[model samples]
Target chain A: MPYGYVNSMKTRPGHRDEVAAILTGGADGLRAAGCRLYVVGLDAADDVTIWVSEVWESKDHHDASLRLPETRAAITRAMPLLTGEFSSRETIIAGGLGVTAG
Target chain B: MPYGYVNSMKTRPGHRDEVAAILTGGADGLRAAGCRLYVVGLDAADDVTIWVSEVWESKDHHDASLRLPETRAAITRAMPLLTGEFSSRETIIAGGLGVTAG
Candidate 1:
């Protein structure tokens, strides 16, 4: 089964866009790291909150991605912009349209 | 851009599978309704919460889907199995792997 999560983060005031950019900046690397999906979304109702929905081949793939140089750099760039408030729901993807499970 | 959200719902005790079944039962109809993705995921840390990640061609398409007979019926059937606890973050999909935005 694919590992996935919908994670929410609050960026420091006036930094949501920057944080979003950092998150999506490493998309190509993530794809190469076995990411099935990596979506960055701006919260419709708030300026400081961003939502990231991701699906990886496995939890190991996701964890390993974070250790990649580019991924680590991106996180460093985004860390300062974040307010530290976050929420996440980790999941075992069951499958649906546009997603092929292994 | 595609309209999307990561929605979480808590099911009544021991009804998670039933609720998940109801959510995915109308998958075919959702595709015809312009849904790009509709992924059902089981929370890794809990048995009662389910996460649904969705992307629609537009918000209008999503709103219209709620009125479909199958959708309405599913909602009705699943309602009793739910705890009324929900959390969602509406989004405008920027772009990502596996999701084609309009």
Candidate 2:
């Protein structure tokens, strides 16, 4: 099974556009790094909360993408626009799951 | 700003209840580690997809919780019932974001 990661973060008020731009600019980099699926969704009621779902071929591939200069730069640019601290966890894919196949 | 983490994973078919049990069993461990808000929400249309949102006092606290034996055991028990791979990213909290006080 392919490894995947879900990253959710809340943007500072009025900074949603800036945050979205940062994410969009780095989409290619993520795709080039073997990201099969990448999506950014906003909370229906609160525009500031953004959730990102990404699927990579493997954890190594995902790690490699993070080391890319472009990815690093994009995150750096987004730092100031983050409203609350973000956290994440690494999980192993153990059957019976599927996506829409992007 | 409070550091929060969202961990999303998909359960094996017909394993939604099991997944929730695992999560519930570990709730105390998370809360004891300074997790202010911990919620497990299943996708509206898909019961297999589960999303967990937790707010911790800091990343260190979150990290500490992960290192605990209970947390490790809980995850290990849930591994076999996992359907798809999970992914996560760490982001810094850099203003204007608020959550409903718990």
Candidate 3:
């Protein structure tokens, strides 16, 4: 089954741009690690927030991505900019454009 | 450009199933109106919450979707079950799976 994660995070005021950069810059790396989707978005209501929607080949791949040294490095760079973790939702992809139904 | 929206919501206790049903049940209608992605997700932290990730052909298409009769009906049916609107982020799809970059 395809695994997915949907989440939003709030950074300190003025850190949104930095966070977006980090997230996007890390995209190719994530994709190389079997991430099918890594969408980076700007919150419409709050300028300091960002959203991420990701789909991975499997839940195992999603978990394994975190252990990659490059990912860990990116996380370290981004950790300081975050003010709070807003919310996260995990799902099993049923079927859609980017994913195949299992 | 491909337009996207990522958001998560909290429903009144015990209302998640109803909300997911309404959202997914209306998927075909949304697709008919040019919606390319409509991912429904359940929150990991809160059982009563849900997440939605949507992609439309254009920002106009996304806006026009709200005016669709079926879309309006679904929204009306869902409004009562919601407890809070948590977050919404709007994005220009740069490039990724499921979308072609312009």
- Return the TM-score for each candidate structure: 0.93, 0.49, 0.72
Give model 2's DockQ, 2 decimals: 0.04
Flag the better candidate by DockQ, 2 or 3: 3
TM-score of chain B of each: 0.96, 0.81, 0.93
The number of the candidate with the highest DockQ is: 1
**Can you list the residue pairs that collide in candidate 1?**
none
What is the Cα-based lDDT of residue A61 in candidate 2?
95
What lDDT does candidate 1 reach at residue B10? 98
Q: Tens-digit lDDT track for model 1 on B10-77?
A: 99989998898788777889999989888889999999999999999999999999999988999999
lDDT of 3 by residue, B1-102 (tens): 678798778899998888877887876777888887787766656678777788888889989989988889988999999986677778765454444535
Residue-by-residue lDDT tens digits, candidate 2, A1-102: 456565667888999768866775566667678775454544444668776545667779998988988888888999999977564444333311122111
Q: In lDDT terms, how accurate is model 2? A: 0.62
Candidate 3 docking class: acceptable
Q: A-chain TM-score per prediction?
A: 0.95, 0.82, 0.93
Going through the candidates in order, the fraction of native interface contacts each one reproduces equals: 0.73, 0.00, 0.26
lDDT of 2 by residue, B14-72 (tens): 99778866776666566677775454545544667776545567778888888899989
lDDT of 3 by residue, A1-102 (tens): 678898778898888888877887776788789888777766666678777788889889999999999989988999999986687768866554434535
Compare the candidates by TM-score and give the number of the best one. Answer: 1
Candidate 3 local lDDT, residue A51: 72
The weakest ten consecutive residues by lDDT in model 2 chain A span A93-102
Better of 1 and 3 by TM-score: 1
